[model samples]
Target: MADPTTPPEPNESVSETEIEAPRSRRRGILVAAVVAVVLIGLGVWWHSTYSEDTDDAQVNGHLIQVSSRIAGHVAKVYVDENQLVKAGDPIVDLDPSDYQVAVENAEAALASAKANAAAARVNVPIITINTGSNLRSADADVTGARATVAQAEEQLDAAKARVEQAEANNVKAQSDLERYKPLVEKDVISKQQFDAAVAAAASSKAALADSRASEQAAEDAIRVARERETQAQAMQKYAQTAPQQIAAQDAKAKQAEAQVEQAQAQLDQAKLNLGYTKIVAPADGIVTRKSVEIDQNVSSGQNLMTLVSLQDLWITANFKETQLRRMQAGQAVVVHIDSTGKDYSGRITQIGGATGSVLSLFPPENATGNYVKVVQRVPVRVDFTNLAKEDPNHQLRPGLSVEPKVRVK
Candidate 1:
């Protein structure tokens, strides 16, 4: 104010503290900037040390393919595409008429086989008893015939002795007659003595003839007894075969029983085939890719539909090799599903054995002369914990992108 555009005189009463105030303020600002930078660096390092996150993750679930077990014409289709179905629910039906008829045929065969078996079994005991009785009767007949033969032989011997004695008496009587005849001729003996000697010879001759007849009868009796003994032996032999015949009958019965069993097994198989006509869901899932329809002729092992199990879902997190240095199984994970915009708690269950590129259908070969270095990604399976309670409707499915953060510490 004293002079315009003229330099003013410096004030000497101002303290050094006041003079250095601006520098102090600048120094304070610089210190604050440095401290802030250090705190930010620490926060970033801590976050990196405790957690690893990746957006290259997807929800994975079981994909089941449903097929027909037998060949048949479809009668009904019960499910459509994307239909929710429970385990053991009837999903399709095939023509069961043929199988039912087969079952009926098998049952009829089984009944017939059982009847045959029963008849065979009944024959076993009856034949056994008849054969056993025949054997006993034949044995008794043989014993009786043996006794008769022995008695006849003794009678024959006694008759032979009697004949010899009669012959000897006849010879003596004849000799006496000859002597008497000579005496009569000589007039030294009476005619009466000669007549008596002749009568005695005739009587001895008759007795000899009778003994001869008795001997012949005894021989005939012996022959008859021997014939009877042979016949009895034949009968006894026939009786001895009863056990073999019984064994044969038992074998027949067993064969019939085996046939019955075979028929029953066929019946059971037919019933199983009939039951197979009704196709049921193997598990709880959402149906998809359903190619079956009503009145379609499907063959065995034909794919009928596909089912996706939304329950028990997991996230397949593909992390870069560098990021996997801090990842491991049993670590806590936070999964955020992009579809539902929801967060789910999970834990790492397993790490893939091979990298994504190595597991690819066309794996890269480094020896191809134009090889380029590239980072590889490894898949880690993260299974949801309490998935049902978190999302009761089973909203998660396979192939849906998700973000997962794994707390390695």
Candidate 2:
């Protein structure tokens, strides 16, 4: 072999132009590197103009509190701390005996009211029937009385004429008897004729007395009929109050119906209270901060536990006032979750009306003599656009640190 570590032999045909070929290749490489740097610089400048990013952000979501709606002694606690539960799931069971008793009482009261209403309604028909019968009977009595009076008046007139005729006949018969007596004494007439005349005169006198008695009876009958008519008229006036009596019964029915309605409302309220004895979850969430236990006496609206929702969440980014110049709602954003080392696509959904400082418990007053101007940060809410794809397992929670980048252009 040739000498070890010796240079290889060169060809004689190679010239300066060929030798400068390597330099030219190196020069091209330098130019390419410079071009790449310039391109990268332009790209960074362009991205800076359109992209607004901030690390002052946090994952935010709803933190619901579980409370008791009714006062009762807890019979059982179904959920513990950090237990996941679905909506309408029972969290606690209170003793429902008292509420059940109230419901039963309400139902009994409603039944009683309805029964009273039915009874009142029944009275209306009965009063109407009785009153109507009284009116009809009274009207018939008045008609009958008037007819009797008319018949009595006609009889009285006939009797008076008969009495006058009887009196005239009696007077004629007496005159004939007296004349016969004188003629008999003078033997001008027979004795039998005089006796006949005397008998006729006595019969006429008896007929006249009977006619007068008949006339008196007719007058008494008329007076009796008139008295009956007056009584019937008075009875008719009393019967005319039938409609008013029916109206009074109707009023009683209405009052009973109103009571029934009131009782129905009470029953509904009792049912609601009974339902409250079972404390059910208002929404799907993870239970935490459990402050209630079995047999605990809880009041209405008292906090029993805390519920945190993990399914729906968003990033709250507090961007500087200067950085919010081109920020707006509905703009695309990128959210970076450091806890999971995940990047998710998002969009700006809301912008706070006031700065964080202004929303604090004690806001700053710039009118103080000794004041220093400070930049304020505004809260921007960014919601996930591809929520399911990025956080399918719901790993994000409220108060978690996150980085959000909002696109300005």
How far out, in Å, is residue 14 in model 2? 21
Which pairs clash (backbone N, Cα, C closer than 3 Å) in model 2? none
lDDT of 1 by residue, 101-211 (tens): 999999999999999999999999999999999999999999999999999999999999998998898889878888888798998887787778889988988999999
lDDT of each: 0.92, 0.90
TM-score of each: 0.73, 0.69
State residue 206's C-alpha deviation in candidate 1, in Å: 14
- Candidate 2 runs further than 4 Å off: 1-39, 138-238, 369-371
Cα-lDDT of candidate 2: 0.90
The best candidate by lDDT is 1
lDDT of model 1, residue 347:
95
